[model samples]
Target: MLVEDEHSLHAINVGRRLLVQLIETCKELENIHRIYAYVESTNLDGIHFYTMMGFQRRETLPDYFPQRASLTPDAVKLVYEIGNDSSTEAIQTFPVTNQP
Candidate 1:
């Protein structure tokens, strides 16, 4: 699971490439199942990047980023499922907060 604010990195290509590399790197470590990301639906470059990386568009939350409507636009929930334990998709259920 990763949360990125596009406002910080307006460069679509950069984000795409970085994400791809991140996924690949993560896969080299543990067994990933599926990756979840929250992106503005109107982010064509972002959608294109995920699609190219073999990620399936899952759902769209109507009102996700009200402030990003005009600024961003495509506010949606993107889900990318790889395959079995060998999957490169990041696991989400792993809640790592603070303990001993």
Candidate 2:
């Protein structure tokens, strides 16, 4: 799971870099074939952000979100295929310079 503080003041690229590094790391793992993220349909920013990060919209799950008194919404399933990429295999390690 990935999350960021809403009140964070870090540079935008910082999040992108971290997410890229996560994908790279997942690609290196032998058992991990793909990365999946579930986003609420009402969350346009999240939908756009994951889409921009090479995740493809695969399916729309109806009533995926819990039904609350206030609101309920469908969920968008996004997936990133990390297996069988020769390029990602070369990157075995990355330095940890920042903590969030």
lDDT tens digits by residue: candidate 2, 53-94 = 998888987887666554335777887777655333322221
lDDT of 1 by residue, 1-94 (tens): 3434445554556656766776776566657767766666666665665677776778876655545324443355666665547545564421
User: What stretches of model 1 exceed 4 Å from their correct place?
Assistant: 1-13, 66-74, 84-100
Reference-based lDDT, residue 43, model 1: 67
Candidate 1, poorest ten consecutive residues by summed lDDT? 91-100
Q: List the residue pairs that clash in candidate 1.
A: 40-74, 41-74, 41-75, 42-74
